[model samples]
Target chain A: MGHVDHNTAREQLETIRTLMDRASTYRRALAPAMTAVGLIGTLAGLAAPFVIRDNARSFAFYWLAVGLAGACTAFLLMRRQAFAAGEPFWTPPARRVASALMPALFAGTAVVGPLVNIHQEGAMIAVALPPLWLVLYGCSVHSAGFFMPRGMRLFGWGFVIAGLLSALAAANPHQIEPSIRMAHTVMTATFGGGHLAYGLYLHWTEKKPTA
Target chain B: MNPEPFPHLDRVIHEKARLAIISSLSATPSLTYTDLRNLLVMTDGNLTSHLRILQEAGLVALSKSTGETRPQTTYTLTDIGRNAFTQYLGHLEQIVAQFRKTTPSA
Candidate 1:
């Protein structure tokens, strides 16, 4: 006879592994759609100047204003999600970074975005946001790994990867980059909507059993 | 013929080593690797191996830090793990009480 009773321990461990697998599956499915959205947002934010104004100087100021506003929208939206769980997602260090980094990043980047039409700095900073987020997401997970659901931990890591790609794509363009805007689509799809999708799938459906 | 659910938590917990680790950590919030090994009266390898298994299962996580001086490692349980452990203890108590009541010698 075997010395160890592997059956019970194996079954319990399997349950957790199952949850993480489902979460990863859900995010992978959603990633492309999100990338598309961010691309669209970037294009829209980029094109807003052509719609409202044409000259470089006027466009820069107007684009900066709108970018600031869009970034503001993103911040507020993130805050709502963070607060909804009674501040569950924001670890103390994460909160500290987000408080200082988000506003400063967005505000600074908005000024830079329209400038991207004429200058490379805007694209550089935009590129930085997603990866910076990725590093932050990893730390957040590794720190809260204990209390978080298995699904949530995987989700955190996924966003980190997605964020890095988005940042890389965003920062590379010299003038009016379409790819980073697409990156936003990717980020939103994977991190924002992808999270909601994973939650909904687990909440609404019973997972099929696996051996 | 008889059929009922098997025990939720059995005498497995009354074992001194596992119980000490679970109960002590429950009060302390989080514990370092050394702290756990010391409390459970286990050797370093014994605790490390168990903690690794727990972490891989997502029941626990270990953190490593390297500051100016040396490295540090710590472990803590996740929400699901904590809940399950708590419920297991409660269910075990109930089972014990039920058996105590029905025993013929009592």
Candidate 2:
């Protein structure tokens, strides 16, 4: 038993608070991944019209494939970063990020099935997919943002708002025609352009990783 | 001087390094040895010693896995540890309250 003073107790309490925050905080080395994803997205957007043309199903599959590729690229980049840092790839925070992302991404993929089935409104469906996917992707990112940097949450919200605005534009035939090309443009602008801009911003602001 | 003025304070968790270890573990589900070391900026010998002490006291648990490169060690707070920490926090709050009660207004 020792004589503990009020000041000592308060200092210990502060130590606990600080340590808890340090332990839980996750710093994601996101610049490279975002840049790579942005490049992939931008390229995919450019190629979509030429490759897929007006076939609604083809358009859907093409973008899905692009999304998958982008996701795989991001995962590999992150894994590489973890390796460089001499840390495990699947840490607690990584698990938390994955868990948070799963539901919304799952919903986005699931919705594509029913959407592609509507044959009569094929053009409308094609146009609709981008916005729906955007919102869902936004939601997934936003959910995962809890375990990531604060900027990530803002990025997620950007996706969500873009999706909503895209949806609104799609609904109004006067504002923008509902076509596969238009859909491609929208995806290109948001997924492609948005990621590139953010990637550039991160590159400028974030500390460069040591070689 | 009063003997054991703060009776509820956990001596095992009272040390600076040990308290820091416990607090870090309390926030997350688990942390690797490297992660904990990096967060606390403690030497390998110091962290190993403190972790050993906490483990002996049934306040922490460790796991080892053979990863791609080497054997990685991870640590987490035990049920006893979590309960102890919660009680420790309650005691600290009480101490602060007691101090406020005795002191006159500024």
Candidate 3:
């Protein structure tokens, strides 16, 4: 037998080990759950102008409903996927993802109280809300994406860009109504549309006979 | 010039299959028997033999759960196994580093 170079052998072993570890992680199954979140966001965005119709309180409640539903969907779907894969929901990779996600989400949640307080005091904080939420959410997803597939990072960047644009458009005092509509539209496109696209991509690319 | 002194490599982990198993187990929290077999692309008999050897050596732990319709067997690296693998890699790196220091470039 040919003698194996210790360095080359070590490198090969490391590569194999990394590939095996990645394969063992839960990736593909998250697609459907993300898609569900996106769909709910899209529906909320479409209904916002009609249902809330310039009532900031209703708008806040509408989005809160959507957020709660999306969170539930994500949790249930992820748990199901983990169970189906015969892996624990609290695996090392899952914990890493949550660790990356939680900080940004918590920061966003902290901002919500102050934003709502400002809105109740009748300052036009509504215009700033969506963009801030989107940016933070994007950051959360982007960081968590490090533990997931390579393509997920792009979605995070997409949200950040969408958020910045939303902020810029809301800068005009006379354009508050338009900006609200635009924000909802952007939320629908990024969260709802982005998730559906990601899910579909995963389904097509990652579908294979499980070992 | 004389070749550098070789580092001691753990023979138990020197085998490719066992090394692969240990490396995989070290990375993940735990792996089912089927998952490990598929990852290594080893036959049932071959994998079982290797796993048995590692178990006997106190390097691996096998847990069987009977909650499912069929009992599920999962494997995890024992602390001893983890230390052994770390030590083995350290030795391999030292050997490589020494070889590079002594050998002339092509």
Per-residue lDDT value at A47 in model 3? 79
Q: What would the per-residue lDDT of candidate 2 be over residues A47-68, giving only the tens digit for each residue?
A: 8877775878888888889989
Winner by lDDT:
2
Candidate 1 residue-wise lDDT, B31-62, digit = tens: 65644654455887877666665666566766
**TM-scores vs. true structure, each candidate:** 0.32, 0.77, 0.82
DockQ of each: 0.03, 0.41, 0.33
On residues B6-104, what C-alpha lDDT tens digit does candidate 3 reach at each position? 335677777888888888888787888877876677999999999999999999999987532345788999999999988877766665665666774
Candidate 1 global lDDT: 0.47
Clashing pairs in 2: none
Q: Residue A141 CA error for candidate 2 (Å)? A: 1.0
Q: By TM-score, is 1 or 2 better? A: 2
Q: Where is model 3 more than 4 Å wrong at Cα?
A: A1-6, A9-13, A16-28, A84-87, A120-124, A171-177, A207-211, B1-7, B37-49, B68-70, B103-106
Q: TM-score: which candidate is best?
A: 3
lDDT of 1 by residue, A112-158 (tens): 44444654433343345445645565456433433333454675577
TM-score attained by model 3:
0.82
Residue A204 in candidate 3, Cα distance off native in Å? 1.0
Sort every candidate by lDDT, greatest first: 2, 3, 1
